[model samples]
Target: MADSQRTSEPTNFVHQDEIWKAHVKVEKDLAKVWPNKWGFLTETYKEYERESLKLKEEARMKLPHHLAARPPTPPEKNIHVSRSPSVPQTTQAFIGWRSAHSHLQLEKYGTVHHGRRSFLKELGWPLDACS
Candidate 1:
């Protein structure tokens, strides 16, 4: 009766048992090593942070003259006047140019559906719905 019941079970049941056993073994192995690995990674990351901050401080100290000599520039009086009118003109021209260029490209290369239809034809696939 047990033999008959085992034989009645799907082949995948046996495969699933093997897969589950392998998964359990892997989990057990990871559990054994995980704490040591986690400790090593944490220590290494902390060391890296300390070294990086030390190097940044050294670089900053070496550049004291460069940092002090460059005074911050005062804002220009005509900055707002210069930006207000030219910005809109420049933006409008750019938009117009981009629109015309994309239209030209669409006419030259066709759309994504056309490309897919050509690819399917190359693969000798049926295009009943594609048309």
Candidate 2:
């Protein structure tokens, strides 16, 4: 019984009108600050046009025609987790190659001269993972 009765909420009559006026005022201020030159107006930028066109076209082409997507197959459970002796040796070799004193460090093997990616890839790591 106590919650049965309710009163109407008070409203501001000029609230919405004031908001529109503020927006118009801001727009006019912006126009004065960054106005068109010689009556020519441009809302968009130029460099972004060329840069975005390729990405936009690629995105447009990638859209699938069908709505249903095929679910991925479950992974195998009994995957082997073995490594060869040479793999560890290669990994240690790779680590030694990147250090400041790498030349002195791996001097036991004469010289460990190799590219950063190639040295790591020789140890069973993917070549493209770094990039």
How large is the C-alpha RMSD of every model relative to the true structure?
16.4, 21.0
lDDT agreement with native, every candidate = 0.71, 0.62
Give the residue spans of candidate 2 off by over 4 A. 1-7, 36-131
**lDDT tens readout by residue for model 1, 1-131:** 79999897768878899999999999999999998878788888999999999999988778867565676566774333221223234665766453354433335566466444466778898777476
Question: What TM-score does structure 1 among the candidates reach?
Answer: 0.36
Model 2 poorest 10 in a row by lDDT: 80-89
Task: Count backbone clashes in candidate 2.
Answer: 0
Q: Write the per-residue lDDT of candidate 2 for residues 51-120, one digit (tens) a residue.
A: 6998999877887867446676556654443332333346657653534354334364776666545665
